[model samples]
Target: MTGSLTAARAMAAAAARLRAAGVADPARDARLLLAHAARIDAARVTLIAPEELSPEIAERYEQLVSLRAIRVPVSHLTGEREFYGRRFKISGEVLDPRPETETLIEAALSEPFARVLDLGVGSGCILVTLLAERAQATGLGVDISEAACLQASANAVLHGVAERAEIRRSDWLSDVAGRFDLIVSNPPYIALDEMAGLDEEVRRHEPELALTDGGDGLGAYRRIADGVMRHLAPGGRLLVEIGPTQVAAVIALFAQAGLVDIGIVQDLDGRDRVIRARRG
Candidate 1:
């Protein structure tokens, strides 16, 4: 923190500062931020541990740590997040891609589909990853927020899938046309009452529209269900990420929508994380 400070010493000080500020993984954050400040991969942090940081890098690290202490998300600070093995450019305008949503990705890739639709495509991780993995596939990704649509579009281009993926702004399926063999969503399922309970990073930094439906949390699902049948091809599939406690309600909603073969997929933590259904 002072003159001629080595990377190891600076990280130790930064970790202590983060720990005192209630960061959950202070050491990890310190290492990552140091790497970012030094313009090096995180894996190289250890190699530079004993070397003194340049005044410029040290100043940059100080600013990053200051923002992080206030609970700004690391992805926002780094300007990117990795989802489904791909890096996505992220901002406060969109929700950070989550690991649990990968459950939906796995369920989606379990079958073959030449066409896919992603609803509420906050960062386009789902649609873009699908197209990247399946070279023959093309997709449409829609979000109500224009900012989210732009974020998704950038990610699609970043992942080399922009040519095959279309990003648009639409409220659920309202502006969408054409049937698809697959549809996916990680909608705003958090209830209004639950907003205050979220972490500071999510509650303060991420977009509210990408986190909550401003109601009982089933609003997005209801909208999607109402229009799904009209947009789904025969035997097409629908996959959605959901909260652990939402299994019964989501299943019932899908069933009422006349979707059959409904089933759940759990995340690595074994929580009910995704619901998959097929058009009858």
Candidate 2:
């Protein structure tokens, strides 16, 4: 780390440091951070493994590793996260897009809709991905946090869907108007009691508003359900990402809202991940 260090050696040292600090997948993170420091793609890290690190790149890598050892998420360090085959700019102001949410995306693209509404659009991954996948579609994405709204907007612009996507700050459906053929949300469903059980990266770095509803975790769903019928077109669809243990609770909420065809979709891990329902 002091002088004339090769990329491989530096990464090996960094990985050991991360491992000692309890970072899961230390080697992978080491490789990725090295690539970031060197201004190269992660895949190219191996090509430069034998080459000596520039003083500047070595210094940069040290700073990044230091942050990672403290459990700052890799996506936050890289300033972006890949979701649904696209990368979205991310920050501590918003929740990092997760792979489990792709279950909702698949369910969304399974049907056709010209209009969509994304509630609690943390990073706009759901709405933006849908619009990107369906070029003819236009959408509105709302979040209670202005910072989240800004993050979502940046992602919409990054994916070339800003022209078709509108990002706004609203508490659930309060400021939203007009009926849409589709509505989706990956709202804050974590219960307050469960907050302490989260990983350091999530518990410390991600926005709390984007992670928990400050209650039993059903608060956002309740708000969404109360107003959904008024905003949904008849026979329109509503899709939401949910915790694995939330299937019964969410189904009951949706059913009470008079949504029909309520069903569950599991993620790659076979856990109940999304609930899809249609307006009656």
Candidate 3:
């Protein structure tokens, strides 16, 4: 840092700092941060790996590395995340899309629907991806944050689904009208007590509104159970992403709300990650 440093040297130093900070994947993160700072593809980092970094790039790289060392998510630092075979823009205002959520997407797409509703849409990854996959399908995505709505809208445009997708600021389905043939949500399920134990990147950098419902982790599920029956058309399907351990509680809430045909889907890790239900 004091003297001129090559890309390889800088990457090594950054990785060392991240390791000391308890980052789980220090070396890989170091290369990714460097790639963003250098405005180069990660695959091409090796070409510059042995080359000296320009002063400006070096400074920016160091700043990004520092942020990453402090537990900022790489997706947030880069402002992009890949989900459902597409790249989505991300920010502190929305939850970063995770691969586990793809289980919900897979489950939703397993059935057919002309209209879809996404609750707590965040960056609109679910609605957008679904709309993209089913070109004729239309979708409405709702979130409580105006910023999240805006971000979701932008993502819809990015994926060329803006014409068929609508992003709105709402808590669940409060202001939504009409019934959707299919509805999905990846709501906040982390209990208030469990929040303190979240990874530093999630606890410190991600939006809390998208992370917890401020009481029981099941609060969002409860709210959804109350509203989904009214919003879903007869014989419609509903799928929700859930924490690995929330299967029983969520299924009970849905069943109590009169939802039937309820089932569970597992992620690749073999953990229960999505709950599937249907309204008669």
Candidate 4:
């Protein structure tokens, strides 16, 4: 059915389908899908808008558009997401790296670190980005999901950090050894009750283990803060990404753990997004 449609028309129709499905950014999603369908850059889609799609690409585009109509994440459909100015391969197995997480990355880079550890290292985006930027830094990333560890390993190789980055299957830091100068995490902070109310794309498509702790949202933070004191070298820093409303509770956990110089960093939106602390 799509073979008979011009590129521009195909995009318009796809946008309509997405809009009808209640997608927030139907036009942008449509453009990205069209570019993906044609196997070309999204920026070039406009140049080819007047052209007709080959039968094969057209059918694939139609199928992807249909999937999007059901609220499947675009990154999952495309199999990639850009984070921290680098492309990270993505899947339903790992959290799709978001631009807001870059706030954590920027804060991490603000200080010099020769070694790093990433807890709950889904897709290895945080670890790999740090290794790539610091060049001399070697890091370890651990995740509870073996599938996530595998995906993160692949991403490490993809980004040319395989030699410096190690991926492991572990619950938080249970299998981790030795202390490090920097430790970072983007642990699940969504309470069990909040999971059901998330957007369909997140609730249905993202892994539940990475989105919630099956109890209060603060469980992961408590665990992280408790276990971190022993693993953090004296003067080492720990940075964690938190839900917008979790700033106070998370800071309290850090204080109870005897961490000092604790502070919060806000995302560009001005909501508290990262909590930073130093081991005494």
Candidate 5:
């Protein structure tokens, strides 16, 4: 914690200290948080840390360190996470976007869909990234949590796609109108019974509303399928990220709801992470 080296060197040394403190991915998280405070990338820290460390920068690193010691997510500490090659802001009010969901983004981008819907669009990473990539597309994002809705709205504007995206506070699609060519959701698919078994970093810090659907993991899937059935255009697709274990149940849920061409999509790790189906 004591150092006279440049800010960059100090940050790296501090991150090594964090690794000793039992933080997983300590260097990566520490480097990212420090870079945010120093207004530089983690790689540049090696050169910059040779310069004198300002009291202000030292204080900022102290705060970020304190938060991480308690298992606070790096995204929460840095206020941003990169997904699908874009950065999205995150806070306690919304679920921090996860890298795995980028698979859903990739699936959406594979097709040339013009209209999309993102249910439970926490922080708006999925929708905003898609719309940003396909500048000609228009979309709607719905979230049951008003705070999440606000965060998604902010992300939309941040990505310069607010004009083409409308974010709303709606339970599923209760308040949304019209149909979309594609619908995507990475909802609270964790079952309530499994909450206690998860790592404390997840159960203790992540928003429960974005982590579990209360009754079972499938509640969100049911709601999503119902909405897609009601609002998806012919040949439109619904791509949803599912917990690896829930693939079979979610696939059946989609089939029961009348969706066709049901299939499981794997993630970078080859897990059955997404359930995609086309409305016939």
Candidate 6:
């Protein structure tokens, strides 16, 4: 927070700064930042419309704005992001789940999976959401980042599914034991060379490991295809989120892994964002 907007005048002034700085939703962002600083919801801020915030809260709010001005994502500034229409806790340690990835969750949910595995799980959003939606299912969310595993585990508990969800640090399926009816992942798929062209917020705030596939952006797909069958039960299905342009390449990778009945699913925008295959 730069500081809180203590009064109507202060909020108006802050709004002007945000607008000048090209924040698309300046008023909404300012209100959101202020509400966070005050430890109150935006609805509550409206209730106290005529009042001035305490000095401490004002200062905090300003700091949030200052960070946002530097291109940090609003989700990061707020430490929360909405995925599959549910809120999840997130930080620099994990990838921020996006709406498009929800398509993968929905595809998996279309089947009544008894056991599920989420590789490269970050923030526990996918696995937790799966267990929550399919009450009879148990899940494991595996990630290389221990910090991310901890955060994801916390989210599982928060959503009342910790007992059914195990968040463990593993490089894909390596060092993990599992045979799941379903598997899914929203792994890092951006090529390192393309990172420089990403949006300011993504490049400036999101973790590079979670954004880039290290070099070709196809590395994650290779790793997943190589390891997926090792932990996938025969007849199980795997659903993975892929970049728009990566649909064909990842499909080929899955084929090389002996997966069959392969198919791609598109997002709302009609981009091929998910690849679903059955383990042979």
The lDDT for every candidate, in the order shown, is: 0.92, 0.93, 0.91, 0.92, 0.86, 0.85
Residue range 49-73, candidate 3, lDDT tens digits: 8788999999899899888877989
TM-score of each: 0.98, 0.98, 0.95, 0.97, 0.95, 0.92
Clashing pairs in 1: none
Q: What is candidate 6's lDDT per residue for 117-204, written digit by digit as tens?
A: 9888889999999999999999888898888989898899889999999888888878779689999889899998898899877787
Residue-level lDDT for 139 in candidate 2: 98
Q: Per-residue lDDT for 19-60 in model 2, tens only?
A: 999999999999999998899999999999999999999999
| TM-score computed on alpha carbons, candidate 5 | 0.95
Per candidate, the number of residue pairs that clash is 0, 0, 0, 0, 6, 13
Candidate 2's TM-score reads 0.98
lDDT of 1: 0.92
Top candidate on lDDT is 2
Task: Point out where model 4 deviates above 4 Å.
Answer: none
Q: Give Cα distance to truth, residue 91, candidate 6, Å.
A: 1.3
Instruction: Report the candidate with higher lDDT, 5 versus 6.
Output: 5
Worst 10 residues of 5 by lDDT: 1-10
lDDT of 5 by residue, 181-239 (tens): 99999889888999999988888878999999887788988877776777999999999
